[model samples]
Target: MKSNVGSVDRIIRILVGVVLIALAVTNVIGWWGWLGLIPLITGLVGFCPLYPMLGLSTCPLKKRQ
Candidate 1:
């Protein structure tokens, strides 16, 4: 699939994911914090499944042939 995540969005996701994961690891939060892995993986891959389902995209469209 094409990348639907923009640079800024990717950065934010990574940051938030890291924070949440860290909190979970340090026991600052609950196991729920481990869910951060979702955003982390999506951000790293530059693709979001929900984006298409929700009709939202942070990426710029490429010109079609």
Candidate 2:
């Protein structure tokens, strides 16, 4: 993938994912917290399949070498 997720976006996703997983594991929240996996995976992969379908992109244009 061509890194569809920007740096800031990736950081946010990672933070949110960590929080959700912590909440779930600690039982501070419901199993719904597992939904955080979506962002976690997408952030790690650097590609969001839904981006094109929704016409959204946070990534900056790459500089040509």
Model 2, runs deviating above 4 Å = 63-65
What TM-score, computed on C-alpha atoms, does each candidate reach? 0.91, 0.87
Q: Per-residue lDDT tens digits of candidate 1, residues 1-65?
A: 98999999999999999999999999989899999999999999999999999999999878999
- Itemize residue pairs with steric clashes in candidate 2: none
RMSD of each: 1.4, 1.6
Candidate 2: worst-modelled 10 consecutive residues by lDDT: 1-10
TM-score winner: 1
Candidate 2 local accuracy as lDDT?
A: 0.86
Query: Over all chains combined, what TM-score does candidate 1 have?
Result: 0.91
Candidate 1 yields a Cα-based lDDT of 0.96
Q: Among these predicted structures, which one has the highest lDDT?
A: 1
lDDT tens string, model 2, 1-65? 66688889988888898889889999889898998898888878888899988988899887999
